[model samples]
Target: MTLFFLNILLAVIWATLWNSFTLLTLAGGFALGFAALWLARGLLAPHYFRAVPAVLALAGFFIVELVKSCILVARDCIAPRPNIHPAIVRMPLDVRSDAEIFLLANLITLTPGTLTLDVAADRSFLLIHAIYATDEAALVAELKAGMEHRVRKVFGT
Candidate 1:
């Protein structure tokens, strides 16, 4: 994912350095950046390009979840009576690396009404704060089904 982003940034830098903002120039820069990465394949990790598809899918998943969460939060704000049932729950994680764990935590925090508090010392669990969670089990299941599952796919774990 960082490679993907660096590629984009390199493209922008390409355009900026050349003082050409045209779409054609941007595309050319992107192609050149891709070629640069391809040439360094032997020097870099083998799985660099393979993770692009999963990263794109993860991005799409995040957008969908963000929209859904925003609507839910908006409804709560618009309603005549408040129906917020806040809770903190420890969510199990299959992710081991610090990067993957941090990404999961950030994604959870970005979603409305959900905040990641801490990761367990063992890194097997994530403690999250949610504004509306009447049924703790259901909330945990929803999170596991939604965010946790997508995150696992993101890291190919």
Candidate 2:
């Protein structure tokens, strides 16, 4: 946590030194600060170093999935004969913490064709409505492997 704050402080200082506080400047400063922190990883919590990359990876994965889903949705909308096979699937959850479950559910809902309908009271499964769920088992497996896995990685759960 301290390292994260320090990284933000470094970004602010870098912007101040340049007399420019644009978003790009701040982002550049952040990248430089992240590099500096990486160099000093021996002096900090090793978990923090691992977490930063995991979070970035999750973000990257989400972006790719979002784009792919958007394209698929758009194609279906424009098709003469739309082939969407929508279904509500019950996906067994492997992520245990409330925060992890919340993040995973929200990510699934944010994507184009999928919406998280509800989580089981026991938090052991999620009800997901997906536009492309021709095979419920495959859809569940894909989500478990993709978003759920990334969420677990990010939270270290």
Candidate 3:
């Protein structure tokens, strides 16, 4: 009964925030949103205030990385480095949640020259193709240190 009320409350919140009208449309939206929240409630844990600082920190880190990556890509494009080591590295992720892993993969893919090629069958690794890998160890460390750590911090898992 509590879950049902919670679901309805969530639905109402969504509708109120988005300002939807028409009985049919509002009902449909509420049903869909409630169902999604019900299904996803298990995966999304109850982290509240703790996430605020982490989110702010991650946002800052992302902006820095974005700027750095753009500059590097521009430099490489202007002066085609003959020794560019574009390689696919499988980064073993410790993040357990499907949503978190997807977020990380999307972030990597969105970055300048890095592409998220695949996720391993076990969901433990991300296959990423990076254009500027000087050394395997350094590249792996950069991916983990630069982004993965921040992801863990932000998502708290």
Candidate with best TM-score: 2
**Residue 11 Cα positional deviation in candidate 2, in Å, after optimal superposition:** 0.7
Local accuracy of candidate 1 as per-residue lDDT tens digits, 1-157 = 5777878888999999999989998988887887898788887665656566567788998999899989999999999987899999988887889988999899999999999999999999999999988988898888888777777777778
Query: Please, what are the lDDT tens digits per residue for candidate 2 over residues 108-140?
Result: 999999999999999999999999989999999
Distance from true location, Cα of 77 in model 3, Å? 1.0
Candidate RMSDs in order: 3.5, 1.5, 7.9
lDDT of 3: 0.78
Worst 10 residues of 1 by lDDT: 45-54
RMSD of 2: 1.5
What is the lDDT, from 0 to 100, of the residue 145 in candidate 3? 88
- Please list the residue runs of candidate 3 whose C-alpha ends up more than 4 Å from where it truly belongs after superposition: 1-46, 80-83
Question: TM-score for model 3?
Answer: 0.68
TM-scores for all candidates: the values are: 0.74, 0.91, 0.68
Question: Where does candidate 2 stray beyond 4 Å?
Answer: none
lDDT of 3 at 38: 49
The numbered model that scores best in lDDT is 2
How many collisions per candidate? Answer: 0, 0, 0
